[model samples]
Target: MFRVDIREMLVEAQPQMIITNDNLNARVDAQVYLKVRADEDNVKASVYNVANYKLQIVNLARTTLRNIIGTLTLKSANSERGRINEELRHTLLSETASWGIEILRTELKEIDPPEDVQITMNKVVKAENEKVAAVDFATATETQADGQRRAEIKKAEGTKQARILEAEGQALAIQLVNEAAEKYFIGNAQVLRKLEAVERALVQNAKVVIPADTQLINVIGELAGVAPIPLVPKAAASPPDRK
Candidate 1:
């Protein structure tokens, strides 16, 4: 009895140089999992429809990679690895359909640029990280400065309000004192003014002339708590002259 091996198989595409859409040379590799369907018609097709199918698969994988990756830049190929693997599997499945081959899964392994290109990319990534860090630091610093400025403004406003309240309080106190003085000491203020004038005149040793009937004498006597004495009339001299 003739037997055909109809089992799942692993095919690893070796690393190969490819030119990307941006004209950069990169080495790429991948792995494809496949199996031949075990039905009678698929078995016959797998036996008769293709010769040395493994080699055909390897070459097809290589050519398919070139066709797929050629449309992408090196950066895109590196970033979209899953997409590349899916596309590769789909293409292989369509091309090997007549051979009764079933594509199970595919995985893109690596896409490596030149050593100098890798170095440059690393440096670019480092610079980008540093730039982001610097922007964050500047934003944090500006935010802190803004907070401090707002706090200072609030503090100054509070101090100004406190001073304004204090000044208003002082003005109110002065108004209250003036109202009390006007209510209770209205006449006393005039009396005190005259008293102050007299005191200044006396202190300067100035001589002051005053008539006997002047009210100043009564004012001095009242301040000293003394009553004035009334004079008695002389009636006896007129009676002696008449006799």
Candidate 2:
């Protein structure tokens, strides 16, 4: 007696076809797992058609792939592989029922577009990344500028506050000196100030010029508690008229 092994088998198909949405040609490689039913009623059908069943499945898969992939653009076709696989598996399972074959699963191995399209996609990605980098750089520059502006404002405010404090300190010092002089000198503050000025002038070894006034001399001598020095008189000249 001859025996048939009804275990599942793997099938791979790489179909190169045109897409219906974009009219671009691409290659789609897929994998499928299938097996014949081991029941007695289906065993006869399996025995009669099992040898040619794989070829028929391959043709059906190619047709289904073209139909599914044709409806999608290159980008969508590349992205929606699972949808393609599911659609292909369902169609294959339904059509292969009479042949006593069961489709277990289907998968898309690869989807490759034309070289020119791939290059365009790469350029698009590069441009998008560059745009993002530019935006980030602008944001960072704006943030830095804002921070520096705030720092400068703070520094100016600090300097203004320091100046105000220094002015107040100087004003307070002048007030204290005025109060001390008023308390100690009483009515003699003016005379004491004049003496201080004269003392400062004398300390510099400056020549002193006294005015020819007896009252001023007497006032100074009275302030110093001494007798006034008498001024010498100049003699009259009469002999120049005779020449």
Count of steric clashes across candidates, in order: 0, 1
Highest lDDT against the true fold, candidate = 1
lDDT of each: 0.84, 0.80
What root-mean-square deviation over C-alphas does model 1 reach? 10.5
- Candidate 2 is scored at a TM of 0.68
Off by over 4 Å in 2: 1-3, 49-51, 178-243
Model 1 TM-score is 0.76
The alpha-carbon deviation from the true structure for residue 6 of candidate 2, after best TM-score superposition, in angstroms, is 3.1
